[model samples]
Target: MSATRVLTLNVWGRGSAWRRRLPLIRDGLVRIAPDLVGLQEVWRKRSGCQAERIADGLGYHVTYGAASSRRGCATQGNALLTREPVARYDVLPLPVPDGVEPRSVLRAEVGATTVLVTHLTWEWEHASVRHQQVRFLADLTHLAERRGGRDVVLLADLNAAPDTDEIRWLTGRMADAWVSAGSGPGHTYTPANGFARKAREPARRIDFVLSAGPRAVHAELAFTTPVRARRRTAWPSDHFGVVCDLTSDPGAP
Candidate 1:
């Protein structure tokens, strides 16, 4: 079979900065022409929906899950876009600490592979939450196996660096795409907040694309100028996009 190109990005919110970054987002998508695209922190306000807009504009099918509880009528969460029709989709609620905001995993089936889109919490003190997230992903893998799925690709802004235990836990059963391809550590989270800018450190390699099966190949980061511009826009989010290519083996299970 042919290889599948996938792109995963975190579009902070539909803020003014996001508008500025949209052109770069559009251009990158046009250039890569990925088969699937996973998005985090997607906003769907009553007046407008960024996920739907992107899907419609790009001519891809879209599926999304709300991370937060319906407080009257606000919805925000993760989204998955695919050139192929989605066979099925669901949302997996994740553990969140008392003071932390809600988060969730959005799963969708594109052909034989299952793609999971997620955005981890920023509460560093709550290590337990991260552990729970890892367990949740493991459970999802098992669920896919039971459904006769051959592969699982998890992509997201994990909010944790590669050296952290949280990342290790999530990647325990999966191979990191970039690492497998021998690519250099591509830092994603740029300096956005005052503290981050003041430090003036290089970006952190927190965003990731991981695969549970061996079919993943040629996985690498997709850095764009829009991502840099968004980082400098004084926004709360400061993450770059991750892109990878997966080729299914003829004998894949």
Candidate 2:
């Protein structure tokens, strides 16, 4: 089986200097050149989707799934980018409780593998809601495994800390790339980020790359550099990205 390099990140939608950040995002992605990329908070307009804009001239097959809509634009959601051709694509809408934003998972079939991308509810008080969403994702993964018998890579900006019940529940079932291979705290959401500081969230590793059938070999944070432009400094997004290398797990079920 072929090895896969996976990257997962939350693009922060169109918030806070997105126009300036988009160029840096494109450049950073070009350098990393991941085999598969899962993006959350991607914005789409009448003109085109953010996935298409990033995939432009990059040779990646793009699939986007809308989770919510903005007033002036069409929608915003999760997206999957595969370097190879995708055999199939599907979108699964997730549960949306009262006062919570919509969310969905983007699924792509590449060769013999299945990749699922999603973003869960963000508020710290929304743990219960995230729990439900995690259950849904777990079911989806199991169903896909039964249907395809293919390797599965689940990527997301889950918005929960590592020690949180939702995260613990998930890592117990699947291999968390960062836990297995990353050094240091592996905090993706840091107060050091100019864009993230406004959110008042403490430094935490809420984003994840998980695999059921692939062995995580190495993992690191990406797009951590802050770029100064037009008298302002910003990282590619409010959250850093997780990049991981995965090899097929021969004994995986």
Candidate 3:
């Protein structure tokens, strides 16, 4: 089948930066014009909703699955955006220990693919929690395949490094876009944390695009978005965006 272009990003729905970064984020998406997007940390305040505004303005279809709302975003959660109309969608709440922020996965179907968007727990020290989450995801993916489904593509901010067990669990079941077709470190996180820009910490490629299916094969890492601003020196969010192109076997699932 023809290739599909997908983008995934964590929009950093917290703090005062949201207002400042909207323009840059909008422009970034417009430039990429991806066929589909799996966004984490999408916000919805009384003034406006991040996904709605972007979708309505750019003519992309959107579906949101909320997990919490400090909600700076009344419906703070994961969002799946597609240039084409979604044939179906599902939102599943993920398991998380009490006190940790709730997590959820937003799944959608467009054309011959099943796309899942999610944001997992962020504690680097809490590998156990991440592992449990990955197991659940693996099981869910298997269930879909058994039930007869198209290629499944998982896009998320996993918060786990490539070499980490949590990521290994996922990569073992699905192909990592970066590993299959990418160069450089593929770092996605960039936290300032009130420190000088470069002094805070180095970036990490916690974000990922993974796939598994009889037809899921030959993935090309299109590029990663910078999210930098023309008006402001700061980035749209603390995370970089990933874009990947995938060619599926037309005769297979």
Candidate 4:
């Protein structure tokens, strides 16, 4: 096993000014130069798509899982952009609640590491759904290991706080990349007006890059800077992005 750098973020989708922030997203990702990146809320249109656009700019391999298709001409989903070509991979539709937007996971291998990219149910109303999704994610990671891969990572936007059952369950099973190699609370989600909302709720860290291997994954706490757009009218996304560097343990199976 060697070294790997992974990043994950919710790209804010096309629901808003996706076009305006596209350059910021591309520049931010290119600046980090991660080996692989996982993005939630990526969109696809007839002419092109977000992942493909960024992949083209950064020269990274692109893989996506469309959760739904609109009128047969448009699509929206999660995506994986890797510096190395992804040869083996699959898109899995995750188990969802009775009536909610369908979700999915993209599993791919870049070189020797298996990366699982996904976005879970959002909002308090879907907490139980998130719980189920977390358990399923745990099962999926283990499944990847059983399939002959040693280094496995989960990049996602879970929409849950750190102490909640969902986060506890996930960090309990997989190593939270930030725990070993991050500074501060690493808050990825914040209220629209953080100062005004603190009385009700503080910021939360929901986005993550969790990794598990038969052996240790050395992560340097050098810097996991959150990329924030400086523009007033538009920002990179509603949530912040995390950038971290990880090296696979030599003894990894």
Candidate 5:
């Protein structure tokens, strides 16, 4: 492939009318047709994993990392979906503060490409924790690239804005897709979405696609529109998804 399309989204776990939201997510994925997908806040149980369900019949292989459990049944975590069969996969537990929700990064190799998916600590006061997590991710990405002999694509709902120290540190080593190619503000978490209003977070771009080698050719926010239902408005997730196209030829543009 001359270019790879990568997408990242925080699926909001099993929260906020999950049953109704699943189809919307599946439909969005179909429309986007990304080669690689990174998802956070994915909930899974014996019935079936959320990522698997969404990827069903889509010809994508899924790898999930369980960060923590929800209630007594479902496991919550991050996931990576690839168009190619996975060559190898691993999960890294991120550093978390006491009494806080657990977080993890999932890595998968497809042919010569490596993809890493993660969800960082979300609280506004948890920047220090996110910093620790980013340091770990940075090192992991470097190691992966060295071993793979190719660029690594990182997808995440980082829960931190672009200017935050955690993101700044990562961007120093990688390229931010939105900054390179997105046309607008690219706010993934905003009160503009009725579902996101419950989070009380200021409008900001927290989702991302970063690459170690490829240059971003195009990018935009997705899953921002709501679907009309008889009883209520349905959105794909609490956060908007991000889609970016990347190319290895730096001189193409």
Candidate 6:
């Protein structure tokens, strides 16, 4: 029973509101005590690092990639935190349509498993960008095979739902972790304002945990933490965190 608990969270960038949510995020991480943590929309200061802060607080090593860069300043794209030593790290930039924000995939090797984290574009009108992103992810399965990696898990805010074409494309080659574990239609993103009276209605299942070469033994929508919308605060991000428990190969260490 070689298995590890993994948690994915999209911490919207550093700003006034996001700063205030740090305690809530830290508390959530403390509660889960996951073996690995995948974070999206993280930012590193010109003189400091955001992932390092989280790693220090949680007692884990961190690896990340940049999605936006200007001169020497870079905005962190996706990050992976692991209790196990990181064997290697790489970043793959995904195609973004014009007028759309940048996106990238961050990959790290933990023990015998390789984890990839990403933040996909949110533009509904840019079908080409979605197509390219899905294609790139599907290609990762092949990449893993060539590298002799037996398992790959991708966690991210895809900005598309289960029924969407992009998701179908990606799932054609990889297993959806939630579906594999029998977690029913978990909604990751909730309206930032009041759930009902909010001007914008939540319509999509943007966040996900997709796995290959292994089965998800347990999965659930992470709503137990105070980060989940309370009466006082809407939420840390417009998206909710997703937790997946993966059962690795019995032979894997």
Q: Give the winner by lDDT.
A: 5
Quote model 2's TM-score.
0.95
RMSD of 5: 1.3
Candidate 3 Cα deviation (angstroms), residue 63: 0.5
Cα lDDT tens digits, model 6, 1-253, are 8567888878876744665577666777788888888889888867766777766757888887888865577676888888977999899889876767778999887777778899888767776688798898878767885788658888888888888888888888888878877455677765532321253756446778888877787778664334344445545455677887888665542
Give lDDT: candidate 1, residue 138. Answer: 79
List the candidate 5 regions with Cα displacement exceeding 4 Å.
Answer: none
Model 6: residues >4 Å from true position, as ranges? Answer: 70-74, 97-99, 192-199, 223-231, 249-253
Which candidate gets the maximum TM-score versus the true structure? Answer: 5
lDDT of 1 at 248: 58
The alpha-carbon deviation from the true structure for residue 22 of candidate 3, after best TM-score superposition, in angstroms, is: 1.6
Clashes of each: 0, 0, 1, 0, 0, 0
* Model 1 lDDT at residue 131: 78
Cα displacement (Å) at residue 235, model 3: 1.2
Clashing pairs in 1: none
Candidate 5's residue-wise lDDT over 1-253, tens digit each? 4778889999988888888999999999889999999999988998989999889998898889999987788899998888888888888889997899988899888777788899999888999999999999888888987775767888998889999888999899989998899988899999998899987878999999998888899999999889889879989998999998999886777
Cα lDDT tens digits, model 2, 137-182, are 8887788789878888998999899899988998888899998889
Among all windows of 10 consecutive residues in model 2, the one with the lowest summed lDDT is 244-253
Per-candidate Cα RMSD to the true structure, in Å, reads 3.7, 2.2, 3.5, 3.9, 1.3, 3.2
Candidate 1: Cα lDDT at 37: 87
State TM-scores per candidate.
0.86, 0.95, 0.86, 0.86, 0.96, 0.88
